[model samples]
Target: MTVEVLRYSAFPEDGAGGNPAGVVLGAASLSEPQMRAIAEAIGYSETAFLSPTSESDPARLRVRYFSPRAEVDFCGHATVASAVAIAERYGAGVLTLETNVGLVPVSTRHDGVELTATLTSPATWTRPAGDSAGEALDALRLAASDLDPAYPVHVAFAGNKHLVVGVRDRWTLDALDYDYGALERLMGREGWTTVHVFWAEDRHRFHARNAFPPGGVREDPATGAAAAAFGGYLRQLELVDVPSRIVVLQGRQMGAPSRLVVDLRPGSDTVEVTGTARRLTLTPYDDVDLP
Candidate 1:
């Protein structure tokens, strides 16, 4: 059998920059290994597989996420890309996705030719990094002095786990070099999806880079899951004011500059991540043989 895999770029900056993802609209017939194979062949950080749900609502879907190496419980960028694709085909509306973590609600809107999607993450929480902070810093080849004093290290979870680390300056954030093997080992042990390193330009604006060794990618140009987790971290620590709109700029160092918007509302445990996705010209993967 053959499957149609669409390519899209999520969270683009001015319609030019973002992370590319593979979106499979009809994947109910594909087995797990076949889906993994498709994701590996696509070579993107993550791919989204959408299957019809038993629910009668057309907007409800059973969504699964996969990286080149393994399956992920949730993926923000892929979700954004998938939502936009669905909206373009079906029409703009709310999509309820049944994921491994839980139900994720995504709302899609269109501004003329441009389509945007917002995903409401699961309940978020944060915990201190504790002894693992040293190991993470060592893997990144940095000392305690490299971290910003204002933001303490923590493990944050929205739909996935991310290590939130804040650095003092843009220079330090830009100069990111880490031991791939060591970081991968630590992430495997800690069950962390990515290590989110960020530099705050101010309370509302920030710059970030994500080390995503577990996904078989050395780094991610844009990480919506980590952004959602980081937003939870900020809210838990009271780092930012309530009802604030935070902007995260990423991927410039990798030359794929991307932007993500995180909205935090007062008295809400769920974080909202908003971004735009554009279809890529890459040919659909309709020729790949699947068992």
Candidate 2:
């Protein structure tokens, strides 16, 4: 059997910028190796494979995420892309996804012009980076003085673990040159998915860049998972007031400017990440035969 793959750019800025993700709507028959091969062929940071939970319920799905290198527990951009793709085909509604981490609820809406998806993450938590902070800095070739005093380095999690590093200025965030081998090794040892380096422009606006070595990507243009983790970091540190809306601008330095909106509500442990996804033209390997 041949599986159909769809491409979509999630968290785009005016439908032009965002991270591209591959979506496989019917993947119940595909094996793990086939999924990995398709993801590698697509060459995106991540691809989402979704299978229905039951015959009657199309909205409840068992979703799996895979990067070019390996399978991941959860992926936000791909989730958003998959939600939009499903919404376009079946009309906008809510979806329940059973991921490797836990249950994630995603909702899709059509605002007349475009379709957008919002995913409520699993329970979030944070912990101090401890000795690993220095190792991360060394790998990034950054000094302690470059870090923002207000936001300390910590490992934050929404769906997957991310090291949240706050830099003092935008220039430092823009000029990110790191030792890939060292950072990859550190992340692998630490079990971190991405290094979320960000600069806070204000209480409501921020800029970010994510280094995803494990995913075999040097940098991600727009990372929704990291965005969700950063929101949890702010809440954990008591940096933001409840019921706050934050706009994270990313991918500008990479030439693909993207935007992600994070919402933190009162008394809610799960963070809500909202973004728009646009379908892309079919790629060469849109249809691939099972091995």
Candidate 3:
């Protein structure tokens, strides 16, 4: 039988921008290898596969994320894309996803022809960059001079582990270059999902880029997970006051510019990342071979 796959661009102002993600709403029958094959075939940064936990509980979904190389614990942009896809069919509302890390709750709001989805990330925390910092910088071919003196490097976790580095200016951020194999090896050893490199335009606005070598991607046009984790980093270190909202401008250097809005609530460990997603197309399994 043919499986169904839907494509959507998340965190974009329109369909032309944002990170493209594949949403597989009917994924109950697919095996692990099959899902991986599908994701590889789709060739998106990440793909979200949904399987209803029970027919009686439509609100509960078992979701899995896969990159071209391997399975990921969670993917925020794909989750946003999947939520918007669900809203298109069932109308905008709330949905709970069972991920590898934990339960994730997503809410959707419709504004005319567009849909915006907000995901409340899991409890977040930060740790010192430690010995990994030197190796990470080496992998990226960056020196200490390029780093932002205001914010130190940190290993942050919202749903997955990420190495967050703050650059001094947009010039450094815009000229991102790295050895893919070296970064992949370093990330694999460190168990990191991505190296989130950012430059603060202001306290509340930032320019960002993510090197996701572990996911078999050179760069992520927009990364909601990293944005959420960065919000945690800001709040944990008291860099930003609580009850703050930050905007992340990403993918500009890559020409596929995208926007992400992150909300940090006082006394709440979970941050919210909100963005708009648009459906691109739908494909049938018959178009490709299954693993």
Candidate 4:
């Protein structure tokens, strides 16, 4: 089975910006194990596997996401990367993706070096968890004063659940060192996918980081799914009114800087996450075992 793999930097139009993802055009012949191995071999946060489905269904793609450690229900940056990659070669329009979560519609448009994608998440919303901010602070080894009083700690869900903790300043965000193994255990016991650590800069801007030890990645440079869910949380808590959007800056300290945009609509929970893509140097190899 041969699949054409393209590497893309999602959430940023620049070639060096955003998160890197493996975009597979056709993986119908690849097994789940093979897909997982390929994703691991690529060593990105997540790799996207796409197979032909049905055009009549309006969802012409069957998509699966895989991290190095396991398969995931959904991945936002990979979706954005795949959309931009497909649009660059196949032309722009609304593309349907059948993910583990549900059907997702992605629309793309390109102008010069600027490529944009709007991904409709899987009917996202927020829910208050059983534990309060106190427990979250304990797990993160942070004080209540470190958190942004405006944006409280809450669990948000788009395709998966994430603990959203907004900090007060960049100094707090830059000094990020958490118990990785402990966090994995806590997230596993709590059924949380990631711990979204963010710092709000202004009304519509945020400096963000995500701890995803559960998925075997210390952090993701630009997490599209978590960004979407964070937008939902902001709306649910009245932190920000609807019909607005947020620009998230992340990964600078890690050196693979990325930008993610989260769009919100009033009276609705689901938010649109948009970004561009640029091809990277990674390739998909068959008959290779991944470490």
Q: Lowest lDDT 10-mer window, candidate 2? A: 282-291
Error of 3 at 153 (Å): 0.3
State the lDDT of candidate 4 residue by residue for 38-113, as single tens digits: 8888788899999889746533899999988889898999999999888877788889899998888899987766
Best by lDDT: 1
**Candidate 1 weakest ten by summed lDDT:** 281-290
Worst 10 residues of 3 by lDDT: 282-291
| Model 4 lowest lDDT segment of ten | 282-291
Q: How many backbone clashes does candidate 2 have?
A: 0
- TM-score for candidate 2, residues paired by index: 0.98
**RMSD per model, one decimal:** 1.1, 1.3, 1.5, 2.4
Give the residue spans of candidate 4 off by over 4 A.
1-3, 55-59, 132-135, 282-291
Each candidate's lDDT (Cα)? 0.94, 0.93, 0.91, 0.83
Q: Provide the TM-score for each candidate, comma-separated.
A: 0.98, 0.98, 0.96, 0.92
lDDT of 3 by residue, 115-179 (tens): 89999998899998999899889989899999999999999999999999999988898888988
How well does candidate 3 score on lDDT at residue 83?
Answer: 96
- Candidate 2 ranges beyond 4 A from true positions: 282-285
